[model samples]
Target: MKRQYLFSAFLAREKCLLYYQGTIRYVVVTADSGERIQLGLKHFQPYFSALGLRGRFRLTLTETGAFDSLEQIN
Candidate 1:
């Protein structure tokens, strides 16, 4: 079944590409339902830094549902 969720997250880490000087972003988020969702930055764009990967923010997503707008919570 499909569902919507609101969660808090941090830019946990990034994987460096050997060929390109870019990154594959990742985040660790604790959902409002107390579930953890770790994923890549296919849809998110949070500011990242070595000492600031733990920036806490909030986002919303729909799993197999509608793709609505996501927001960052302060």
Candidate 2:
């Protein structure tokens, strides 16, 4: 099995964090050839929508020695 990153996102309406236990299937390289992981939030749309989150939600990554926000992860 391929190594995958565990992700989490902040739900505004819930006023709390929503954890997404899933894997990133794609790896994107930057202009400098640095590898970056990409994860889609569509799978969690129902959960987020139910929480009344209209705008973009904040993502957080929870990995050993790799805990970071979405912006920092990229």
Candidate 3:
């Protein structure tokens, strides 16, 4: 089974990296409520070029509450 969540965030400009579970290319963002989110480039490749640093978007999180996809909101 899997779960999905929706939230708004702003892409962070500061370079940050995570090697969690043997994965890299993670992008860090700040949630609307001030929570920091780490999104992986592997999952966000399609939207990568479209979303600039500090860009705002509505995130669709896959299982484990890790963002799977996104739609630009601003």
C-alpha lDDT score of every prediction, in listed order: 0.51, 0.39, 0.52
| Model 2 TM-score relative to the real fold | 0.26
Off by over 4 Å in 1: 1-4, 12-23, 49-56
lDDT of 3 by residue, 1-74 (tens): 34333455444323222332344577566666677777765554444443324445677766676645676666
Query: On residues 1-74, what C-alpha lDDT tens digit does candidate 2 reach at each position?
Result: 22334333444544323334333322222222233545444434555555643433234445553424433232
What is the number of backbone collisions in each predicted candidate, taken in the order shown?
0, 0, 0
For all the candidates, what are their Cα RMSDs to the real structure?
Answer: 4.6, 10.7, 5.9
Worst 10 residues of 3 by lDDT: 12-21
Worst 10-residue stretch by lDDT in candidate 1? 12-21
Per-model TM-score on C-alpha atoms = 0.44, 0.26, 0.46
Candidate 2, which segments miss by more than 4 Å at Cα?
11-36, 52-74
In model 3, which regions exceed 4 Å deviation?
A: 1-24, 50-54, 62-68
> Roughly what TM-score does model 3 have, to 2 decimal places?
0.46
- The best-first sequence of candidates by lDDT reads 3, 1, 2
Candidate 3: global Cα-lDDT?
0.52
Give the deviation of candidate 3 from the true structure as CA RMSD. Answer: 5.9
